[model samples]
Target: MNRSYEIMFIVRPDVEEADLDKLIEGLTGNIVSGGGEVKAAEKMGRRRLAYTVRKFNDGFYVLLHVLAEGGLITEIERRLRVQEQVIKFITVRMDEEEKRLAKVKALRDSKVKRSALPAVEAVAEAPAAAEPAAAV
Candidate 1:
């Protein structure tokens, strides 16, 4: 059975971009070779850490969406643990309900629909005498 996961990892800021690329490439390769498929990945540029980690105050963040077997995920986590450059990481498994909700959210996020009523009308009905605002 295939399972979906959202993985986020933080790496030390001092690490070079090439090294970071190698780490991500290595892990993704491992996932595919171990029977998994990567869906989406986003690199959230380096930023200050909430609290110091390994005596550092900032780290680079990366997020990945992937589908894989259960056992492969365990190995992925294990590989992350042994890396000196990784400060912290998290993986969230999507259950049936969560997966359904994610699909709904994706659809909603991509839409471009305007409401029939203006903001004020939607919030509260005005007196019958009030005139509609002039169009821009």
Candidate 2:
């Protein structure tokens, strides 16, 4: 049976872009060998992490949407765990019901115009100050 997954991983901030591409190439090759088809792949770039991890404040993020056999996800995750460059990783299963809903959501999101977003001031009231600042 075919199944879908959303896999996300954070690589160490020190990795060069060329090495990162090589790593991605190796991983995708493994997935394809294991009978998986990559749907959407994205590099979300480096961003500040909520908290420090291994003394690093940022990580390079990558996300892959794939369709593959159910058992392949476990194999892929195991490989990731053994890789030193990967700081964190996760693979989430997407069932048929969720897939359908995701398709609908994607379609809806694509149709919305960025300029059509409502003005922030018109949407809510300003908050009052809770306490006055003390003089130095």
- Best candidate per TM-score, number? 1
Tens-place lDDT per residue, model 2, 1-136, is: 7788889999999999999999888889889999898888899999888888778889999999988887888888988898889988888887776979999787655534221343344433212211111110
| Candidate 2 wrongly placed segments (more than 4 Å) | 96-136
Off by over 4 Å in 1: 95-97, 102-136
lDDT of 2 at 80: 88
Please report, as a residue range, the 10-residue window in candidate 2 with the lowest summed lDDT.
127-136
- TM-score of candidate 2 versus the correct structure, residues matched by position: 0.71
Instruction: For residues 1-136, write the lDDT of model 1, one tens digit per residue.
Output: 8888989999999999999999999999999999999888788989998998889999999988989989999999999999999989999997676879998777554431222234355544332212332121
* Candidate 2 displacement at residue 109 in angstroms: 15
Q: Please list all clashing residue pairs in model 2, or write none if there are none.
A: none
Tell me how far the alpha carbon of residue 47 in candidate 2 is from the true structure, in angstroms, after superposition: 1.0
